[model samples]
Target: MSDSLSEAWDFLTQAAAEQDDGCRIPGRSWVPPILEDLVLAARNTSLSRYYPFTSHARLRFSTGPESWIGNGDDLAVGIALVPEGRYLVCTQASHDAPVFVRLETADADEAAAMAEHLVNAGS
Candidate 1:
């Protein structure tokens, strides 16, 4: 994992431990819903560590036609390999407005697993 990912993972795992429901990470000051969902899913699943990146690049996604506005940032993203499959989740939100997170999957199974998990975890 890159230092940013490791830092983010540590920050999130700690937040989950402290809040049960997550609070924003300090210093960074933004919590895109996809990251929030990941935090909650980690909390729900007892996620305790960070996974190394399979490869390196600036991980970004459009979220396509699903695009909408909200309260914080223009975009944010994260990646993970779950039992279901590899996933790239993205979000766009701003302050005092609605937020939306979109999940991109390497395959349909991952898509199904993530959709179910997001709902089940109440994200």
Candidate 2:
């Protein structure tokens, strides 16, 4: 893992430890919602403003059409293996939640797993 990624992981881990409700770390800032664009992003989100997320595999971010958005649900956030790029570490928030913490890294599984444990432990 890169130094910056390691730094981010440390911060998130500590934050998760501190939270009593849950470790709701912010996800990568989302771009405008568009279908084709999101599809393309699934393939090449690295080329766009999401160059940072391309490193980690555990996290991913997909800005898409309205239909794809979930109204309210408990989406699982955990470790996952992905292609050799960044992934999104987000929550299933409501419509008005603005995206934040555009995390960029290469070690997704490690980061995501740590986050999951932290979140679960916090709650």
- Model 2, 4-112: lDDT tens per residue? 4334344434432344123223343232112222223222322122111211223332222111344223223322232333444443344356433323344434344
lDDT of 1: 0.37
Q: State in Å the error of residue 66, model 2.
A: 17
Cα lDDT tens digits for candidate 1, 77-115:
334333332455433243345435467665534443454
**CA RMSD per model (angstroms):** 13.6, 16.8
Candidate 2: segments with Cα more than 4 A from true spot: 1-72, 76-84, 121-123
lDDT of each: 0.37, 0.32
The RMSD (Cα, Å) of candidate 2 is: 16.8
The per-candidate count of clashes, in order, stands at: 6, 15
Best by TM-score: 2
